[model samples]
Target: MISRLITILQESELLLSDQEIESFSEVQPLLNDEDIADALWLASKIGSAYKVSEPAAIKAVSESDDAIAIEVIDDNTVVVAPSPMVSAYMPPAAKSDNGSMETPELGLPIQVQAAPALAHPREISRSLRPLLRKVPSLTRSELDESATVNRIAERGIWLPILKPSPERWFDLELVIEASKFSFIWQETLDEFQQLLEGQGAFRNVRTWTVKEAATGQPQLVAKRQQGTGIEQDQPLRSPKELVDASGRRLVLFLSDCRSRLWQQGQIHDWLTLWSQHGPAAIVQLLPERLWSQSELDVGFAVQVGSLMPGAPNSKLQIRELPARTEIAPADTLTVPLVTLTAEALKQWALVVAAAGRQRSPARLFDLSWVSDPERDQAMAVIQPQSAKERVELFMATASLLAQRLACMMAAVPVELPVVHLIQQELLPEVQSVHIAEVYTSSLLEEVRPNRGRL
Candidate 1:
């Protein structure tokens, strides 16, 4: 019976390798009914597995001069199978739910368990199956197959920064981590130099000048040495000489500690100082973060000269003073230099308002819609009139569009009409309609000409 089975396998061109056949011969005496059934099952499985790998195997085996074919009959007769002049091709089998074939038991006087291994059938099929029959030895391509499968299953590449291009008229400086002073110092100096060099009313402007503000006899020749920088010194020459050398501008002096303290009340005192003592058209460029802090109290000092009745001399007195204006910083601070244009400011304000609206429960729709189409559709449904309301509507529509797009891209089935309804028809109508009552009414009529269609 064993020889008949072996001959049948060989005739069908489902023969095992020489080594496998030898191993089977040694174990043939241990076979039982269950072992026979398992062997038959394995043969059937090998047939199915070959379908996937047959093309490669055939190409390999057909190249060998020793390749042979065999056939089997239902009556258990064995015969030589025919070989095609050119290799024949077969389509891979459709995947099936049948578990992998179990190995036959050695025909020893031992109890056998019929249960399959704990591993999945697909895994077992891949591990043990051969691609072609009556062709030399079968080689497992498990690793290569697994790698191909994994490559096919992978998703898109994720990057840390998605937006690589900078927006128009906007400059972005990103620093992972650094001290604030070190970061700002070079950038600020460069910007200031550029502005000075550029053609403008303030081009080649000077910030510092020294002149005697008092007149008096040389009662006590008190010499005071000052820092050598342009803005740090007080003039030693006579009042007329000083005026001729520099300009008739009042001087102010503050310690480095005082300057740092004044920065605490940045926006208010800085603006005030510029308005009062500095040039009428001057602007103070300070750190954006420093200007944002609202707690600091600031003070300034102005120098005035008292003329003496006696000789060609003066008494310069430095008087402490208060600021002329004050303002608190908003949550979103806008740098006047970068976003100075009216249109840019307006757009920025809208964006900030939209961001705020997204945080509110009542404005949940704003967070839902992101894409322009969906936002327009949602707006069509819930038409907003005011600028603030429109921003809220756009945000809600954007959120909804994002959610729908994500669902679609993920291959998770979703209702098509719902996606279209929110993104297409509704959002466009809302975005197009003007805010005026008459205009809005006409627009609505034009958008929904067939009221029953929606």
Candidate 2:
């Protein structure tokens, strides 16, 4: 009977280990009719839980003569009829002495519910069960290839690649543009401005007050008048008001109301505003306190442009800011920004892919990676230290990297190096854009238990 049951189980697509089969055989003799029923039910449950086909589970049930009935609850669940033990567990009728008063209620047998069927001991063991669910029987060649690739992809470790460098310095500019319109939240701006005035670049700053048309609130606009004898009380609201700034580049702080920086519309707006002022260049400053996170070793953005002139995408550059660079305690701080020429952008992409190979906490690249054949070949040379390490690597790069890159695309496909070839092919047509900017300020506030609230 045990051998027959094993054959049925295998026919039903339930693969059991040798030890499991032996254990099932050992316990087969001890199972009453009820136990057999329960075992069959357990088998059905196992098949369903492991995503085995419903037909396979049904076939297993039909093969078992001991199983009076089988009912499928869903693709993942099954129900079996009550065992003989359950049907036979009625309470014995009470005996009446002399049979003088035979009360129907007292003579009637009381029905007792049967206990739930127990799965095979070996089957119930967590360690052994996982081994059983090793694969599905999908055998199509295309499907098999897809499944294999997906399994590897799901493992989440991006294989890093090393390629020949172009040997030219990435000529990029970090344009820090400031506008008279303050983008900083009023309270945050006030506090930060006070701190700046107390310490670094704004030691001798002149201020002008203007009432906002929308809010009717007084907005204090600050300017660092170090050399030109502009009075501290001069009322300057717009870029046009700065008459003393003749030939030199105008550094103004424009408040970015919208948080997303990659939007083409935002870039267009900046360009339009810059064109009006006629400054040789513009400098934009992001709140340093908000950007600083231990995860990112660097603290600055670079200037990057496309290979094609007038590409629909913005010419914004991104790069790692050195951690040790001195920050002036001013609302406006100056730093060199790099612009990415066509070749430079490609080189940067290669460098980014290479940097991802290192197992270190970094912030330069949004948690995204592009796969290349060369990178995969390079990564194949190194073996993961242990199972734990391999698992960790998968979890870090898996969905995180892919999702971030998707977001960076923002409905427009930019031909970036190091991404998969398929992604490049799909770029022009892939319209979905999901951008997620990592603001470390919020994370820092949450993780620092000992520090006071920012």
Candidate 3:
């Protein structure tokens, strides 16, 4: 308190005698810490407010603002009128040469950047336009009868003379597996949901996150808005809820297909029920090249074509589907797996709508992967000890994109802003998932958690 008083006296341009400074010791004990703090704050505020003085000037009538006035209302008291334009509590604003108050120049508004998707968003959306759908309701939607008439005139014989309706659509449910490995596809699935909504191919596109419940069964959950403006998931439903036996709901599962459940037959069981009831399929996140490495068994490769082929009389003739006489019973009934590519997706939609007439082009996964995976093949495992060895192992096992990003980031060694720079400027294909891959690969360390720079 005594030293503070001395400093306050010095700032006021007043040199106090040693004896005068010592006199504050006598009053220091009488004031509490709160009182001392208030005094110091007030002294500092007054010092900054009036560090320098200038002559007062009046403004024109057009800008006639409220003026602050000090009035002697009592014998030993003064009442100062408050001005709203600039409060006395705040430090006075500095004016420019033209007499206008100066402030920092405004900059652009900040925005949060979204993560990049696996493929071009628009292209993927366009490719999904031919998803297998139930027959559209001709009565409820606009139809082109001219096309039906033209088709009848072109063909010598007329069938039902039905018109095609594009507007009538059904509800769709997209279930994304909420697991460590599967979460990497979160950005892709989110963009997919938005694209489905934009396409208006479904009456309503509902998104769900599938997670294991306490009962050890995988349950489906949907996110809902709470009254507090926060998001919360709805109560998880039983596995049976995942299957609409009436075939009214269309469900699509976005998964990496490497989970333990897939090998345990749990995923297959649910898919069986869903496929039996309604249009259901799995969208594998991994590329087609890596499909063999996943839990899905490498079944016999067959070309999926239409049920009828080489009908010259038919205006729209499709290739013939594979014969069922030679194929095993297991291959005839199995869940369809598809990649995000247009060709794979188109074939999947065909098999889905074929309704027993045709099956997926991909092999019917064998139960060997689920029952006895180690029967024929020997597993090779390596334990890396050194950091360099660990990094080498990670690079060997990581995705090609992640490996590329890790090499680039290692060479550059940037910190926080490096993500946007790499994604936007250096490599447009770089995704937040790839950056995270490098973070988890043991190739980078958190040098300083609190700092923006590393």
lDDT of every predicted structure (CA atoms): 0.27, 0.32, 0.57
**Residue 127 CA displacement from its true place in model 3, Å:** 0.4
Which window of 10 residues has the lowest lDDT sum in candidate 3? 309-318
The digit string of per-residue lDDT tens for model 2 on 187-223 reads 2333334432442221132333332333332333444
Root-mean-square deviation of candidate 1: 34.2
Which candidate gets the maximum lDDT versus the true structure? 3
Write model 3 residue lDDT over 199-288, tens digit each, in one string.
766766777777765655576778554798465868866556756444556777887765555645566666656655666667876655
Clashing pairs in 3: none
Give me the candidate number with maximum TM-score.
3
Of 1 and 3, the candidate ahead on lDDT is 3
- Model 3 misplaced regions, further than 4 Å: 1-119, 132-134, 138-170, 214-216, 225-231, 239-249, 297-333, 340-363, 368-386, 394-401, 411-421, 430-454
Q: Write the per-residue lDDT of candidate 1 for residues 1-454, one digit (tens) a residue.
A: 8897667667667877567767888976546799989987998988854332222233212334556654434344456545546755544455435654433333355433322211122332232111111211122222344445555567432322221232121111111111112221222223333333331212022323222223411111112325752223333432221121111122111111112222222222222332222211111222112221211111212222222110011221212223652323221111111111223222322222222221100000011122124433332334467767754543443334343343342342122232233334333321101111111121122222232111
Cα lDDT over the full model 2: 0.32
